[model samples]
Target: MADVSANPRADREENPLERQRELMELLSQETRHSIVQALLGHPKLLASSAELNHFVPSKSKKTVEEQLEVLVDAGIFALYEYPPNEDRRGLPWKFYGLTEYGADVLGDFNYLEGVPMARAVHRKTRKPEQIERHEAAPRPPLPESVRATFRLDEETD
Candidate 1:
């Protein structure tokens, strides 16, 4: 295996923003980003999918699972398999935490400010369709009664 400490020539050639964008694309959803942020806050700590569900209450199990797979594939998270003796009769429960690269990217954001990892990630992962959906489908206008109830122009005399 090649020395892991040294950056590959290819990686060196890529611009920093591009790399951050790739990382962000891997962590696109709110749930996935929350998971990574939580792990960054607590390094090397393993969190089960159930635990993750608790952390991101809005996301469904299937959604979280998909995000976790993406993170694992992107090398942002390390998945650990539980020993057979620990739990039997079901699929092995996997715990995930941030990898060294994940940590570095997060750390560089908090400490260095040398690169905008979060923005880059958002830019890379955000799709034009997604933007259009959000923009085109504005929320329904508030009920007239509800709107009248909180009129900013009317002042208590």
Candidate 2:
């Protein structure tokens, strides 16, 4: 019989760039990146569609669903049903968490294995005082004419 156990590191040592490229492609999209980050931070926390929707509020439901599908297809997440409970229809809601492969990828220490730019820069630069002061010093609201042109529900089909 052929050897069933092979050292995984052999492949990475053989083609590190290719593996890095694959990882980067998987996390290229902002929504996809956010989903991965969320799962990474809370591995055991099952995130539902609604929870994901709230986590990435700027994205539409359709977009969030698409991201979840992509992650599942990439083998980064697994889907499972929530247990039946009161005040709920118990309809199967997709929950996502990192797979073994995902954990391995995340654990990889190579800098090339992730987005080229670090997300920490944005967080470090945005001080709470800046946000609070900006919030308190809000400028005039949008003009009525511009407000009339804006429709929150308007979306491209």
TM-score for each predicted model, relative to the true structure? 0.53, 0.53
Off by over 4 Å in 2: 1-16, 83-87, 90-93, 109-157
* lDDT: worst 10-residue window of model 1: 134-143
Error of 2 at 124 (Å): 16
lDDT of 1 by residue, 68-149 (tens): 8777666556575555424543332456655555445555555224223533543354334433232222122222332232
RMSD of 2: 17.4
Q: lDDT per model, in order?
A: 0.49, 0.49
Each model's backbone clash number = 1, 0
